[model samples]
Target chain A: MQRYFVNADPSAEITLPSEAAHHLLKVMRAGIGTKVELVLADHCVYLATVSVTEPAAKLKIIQKLLSNSELPVSVTLACGIPKTKEKPELIVQKSTELGADKIVFFEAARSISHWQGSKQKRKIERLQKIAESAAEQSHRNKIPLVEYCKSLDALISDYPATKRVVAWEESAKQGETSALAHQFNGLQAGDSMLAVFGPEGGLTETEITKMNNAGIEAVGLGPRILRTETAPLYFMAAISYAMELS
Target chain B: MQRYFVNADPSAEITLPSEAAHHLLKVMRAGIGTKVELVLADHCVYLATVSVTEPAAKLKIIQKLLSNSELPVSVTLACGIPKTKEKPELIVQKSTELGADKIVFFEAARSISHWQGSKQKRKIERLQKIAESAAEQSHRNKIPLVEYCKSLDALISDYPATKRVVAWEESAKQGETSALAHQFNGLQAGDSMLAVFGPEGGLTETEITKMNNAGIEAVGLGPRILRTETAPLYFMAAISYAMELS
Candidate 1:
């Protein structure tokens, strides 16, 4: 069954958006009486039957499905803006599928790409589309938000979690093995975490010092090196395994 | 430092291949005394210095780096061939970076894309290139091999591991919380695991039955529904966290 994320409350009757309506009626060829999953603003999954498909897609509530596949602990990934455009797109799409609550692209000392005034909104819009589609495909309860930060300073000051850490290369180089797992082990349900990653070149000493001052601990992913985009996905998976699967 | 994979003996000093030489000298623009890391056929990282950079790049070994980033347990990922061409390439590239030893593409019952005679070989070659590049970029000791199986039957009969498991949706649907982490926890050093995943449409009931009969355990990744490519990366990261980092 096709799924759509709507901004209306679950109890309210709402028409599907234009893009979603086209997808349901034309792309999916959903007909009258076709059942689909709808995620309303309340983040509840409801089964709705298609009432009308001619003018625009309309649905009537059938029954609520008892389905919840979200992570117990919400994860907000704070990544340094990478050198290329494709990296951020890939990060948002894949991370949304892996159950991220939010993704913020912050400019680091080594960051080569910068999102200026108008370009920032357009970039976030494009990435948010990717996140929305990925959320639908993955059957997520909430669509992850994609935003940009002008600098690491702004990102560190804005986002605060129960636990905060950076994926530091020096940590791995110095053989800091249990820090990541230890932090993850202490997380409880409803707790959120913010993980910081570097760009293509990697995080500098000054950046590490700043994070240290902000009370963000440095954690190593593993012995092997991971690319800028790969590190966040690694963190997502590790967090899921530790908090949800373990 | 630049890294390259050479299929030469560990003790022997081998000349860099033409392609690798061009990449080192022309693309990277390395100096005559530039130091680089090379992975030999023995899967050992060796520190080598450029002896000559005139026409072709030449390097002489100095000493072994004594750095090993491989997972304690050998991993063989048996993934169903995904629909798009880019997905398999992405899986191979990312999994190689995450330290997968081998990657096999099998034809699942729900697979949309089929690899024919010449197409299979071409796909394997293309994915092999991706794995090689990713291995070098991630500073891996070995390049993960990319291969294909004709059917699920062939995949089951061919590869045997100390422990065999399938990433089943039912396990995730039932919310089997401890299955994946327990499986990882039970693994010992040098133990090899073969993990199977479904295609886009997912594995059928009959296929699951067949694997269960073959002593392959079915385990869920997490609560959320992961895409065909995302699931395997999650498995890789979890394994790294459990065996490498923890």
Candidate 2:
């Protein structure tokens, strides 16, 4: 069944939103009596069936499902805005599927591209849409929010979590393998984590020192050198494996 | 320093391949005495210096560096060919960075597109180049091979391994969380693993039965519904985390 995020409270009938209605009626070609899944504002999945069509599309709620696909620990991925537009899109789409609570793009000391003024807003909005579509496609209960920060200072001050770490290539080069596993060991259910990644050229030593001063430990993903965009996805998958599977 | 994979054995003087020579001498603008890392055919990293660049660029091997980025267990990813060209390319590139040893594309019952005749040869060759480039970019010692198989039966018969698992959505829907973990627990160092992933529409019942009969186990990556391209990547990252980190 197709899934869509809805904002309204649970009721006997739901008048589908204009965009979702068009997608269901036209794109998916769903007719009256077609079944679909709606994730309400409460982050709960509800089964619904189309009951009315002509003037407006309406769905009758069948029942609420016992599904819970969200990760146990909330994860926020803060990345330095990469050089190319496609990198952020790939990061948002893949990380959403891997179960992220939020994604933040901040300009770092080594950042080459600046997301300024209206471009920042448009980029975040576009990435937010990508997250929403990916969440629906992955059957996620929550859609992750996409945000931007002007500087690493803003990202560090704004998105504090129970545990914080940065994906540092230097750590990998130094053969520091267990720091990430150690961080995962300390996480509890409902705890939040913030993982920061560098841009293409990588984080500067001064930036690393600042983050270290702020109590953000540096950890390596593994031995291989993952690209800036690949690092966050690897982190997400590793998190899922640690918390969900094992 | 930039890294390149070479096909020659370690010698006092080694001539760089035309492509690697072009990248070093032209693209990178390297003069004599420029230092770079080279991975020889023995899957070892050697620090080398540019010696001559007139007729053919040659490097003088300085010393061997103690570095290994390969997974403890060899992994072979056999995927049902997806519809889009970008998917196979993404899988090849990302999985190479994630430490896959080999990648095979096979036609499944629900596959919308087919790879036949000269097109198949060209597609596999292009994907192979992608894997090689990704390996170099990730600073890996070995480049993963990309090949194509005709069917699931050929995939099973041709690629035997110490353990095998298929990423099945039904297993995920049924809340089979620990199967993948159990499989990872059984893998030993130097052991080989083969993981199969379905295409967009997923594997048919008949294909699943054939694999089951062949002693391949079905395992769920996690609770989330990952796309065809995303599933192999999740598998790769999970394996890396299991063997390398925790």
Candidate 3:
């Protein structure tokens, strides 16, 4: 059954948002008695059926299903804003499928394109939509949030987690293989992690120093040099494998 | 320094391939004395400097660099050919960066598109170019090959490995978590792994049964539905984490 995220409390009947209702009614051709999964305000999946569709799409909740498809430790991926438009979109879509809790694009020292004023809001809205669709497709119970950070300092200050690490290319170059796994080992259930990544030219030395001072350990993904966009997805998969699968 | 894969043997002087020469000379504006890393026939990274730019670009080998960016265990991704043209391209490029040794596209029962005759050759050629470029970008010593398997049976027969597994969604739905880690644990260094994935509609029950009978274990990536392209990349990153980083 197709899944849609709604913000209503657990009740006998709930009305879906306009976008989701349109998707269910026209796009998916869902009619009366059509079954679907609704992730309501509590971030829980509920079995639902189309009860009414004339005024608006109202779903009648049958029973709450025991579905939890999130990572044990919440992962917030703070990436340095990449040069191209497609890189952020790719990062958001793929990382959502890989089970990211939050995706934040921060302006780095070498960032070419800057999202300012109206552009920032518009970009976030578009990326948020991508995340919602990806989460539904991946059967995730919760949709990951997409946001923007002003700078490295602001990102670090705002999103403090139990564990903070940076995916530094120099760390991989130096063959520091154990740092990432060590961070993974240190985490317990319900702990959140903040992983930082750089843009095309990579993080500057000053930025690295600042992050290091802020207690963010620099770690490497592997020996190969992953592009600005590929590193975060690699981090997400590795964490899932370590914490969830292993 | 830019890296290029060449078919030449390690020597004092070697001529660059036409494509590499054009990229080095025109695109990058590299001239005499420009440094480049060349992965020659021996699959070793050699530090070379441009010796001539006339007629055809030539480079003089300085010394072999001690660089090995591949995973300890070889990974061969056998994917059921995806529908759109971009998915295969994305898979090849990203998987190459993540350290895949070889990538094969096979025709699955549920596969929508079929690569036939001249079209097959052309598609493989285009994807191979993508792999080569991605390898260079990722600083991989070996360029992963892109090939087409006529069918799943052909893929199984041609590529025999120490371990063979398939990324099955039903396995995840059934809550089979440890199967993938178990497979990874059984692998030793220098061992080769063949991981198969389904296309959009996913592998049919009959196809899964055949693989099971052939002793290919079905492993779940996680409790999520990965798209045709995302599944292989997840498998690649997981293997890299288990075998290389961890």
Best-performing candidate as measured by lDDT: 2
Clashes by residue pair, model 1? none
Lowest summed lDDT window (length 10), candidate 3 chain A: A7-16
Q: Which ten residues in a row have the lowest lDDT in candidate 2 chain A?
A: A11-20
Q: Candidate 1 regions off by >4 Å?
A: none
lDDT tens digits, residue span B105-153, model 3: 9999999999999999999999999999999999999999999999988
State the lDDT of candidate 1 residue by residue for A123-210, as single tens digits: 9999999999999999999999998999888988999999999999889989889999889888899898999999998999999999
Residue A66, candidate 1: C-alpha displacement in angstroms: 2.2
Per-residue CA lDDT of candidate 3, range A1-246, in tens? 799998889964699889899998999998999999999999999999999998998889989899999999899999999999999999999999999999999999999999999999999999999999999999998899999999998998899999999999999999888999999999999999999999999999999999999999999899999999999999999999999899
lDDT-better candidate, 2 vs 3: 2
Q: Per-residue lDDT tens digits of candidate 2, residues B1-246?
A: 899998888964689889989999999999999999999989999999999999999999999999999999999999999999999999999999999999999999888889999999999999999998999999899999999999988998999999999999999999899999999999999999999999998999888889989989999988889999999999999999999999
Native contact share for candidate 1: 0.89
In candidate 2, which residue ranges exceed 4 Å CA deviation? none
- What DockQ does candidate 2 have relative to the true complex? 0.90
Give candidate 3 misplaced runs (Cα > 4 Å). none
Per-candidate TM vs. native?
Answer: 0.98, 0.99, 0.99
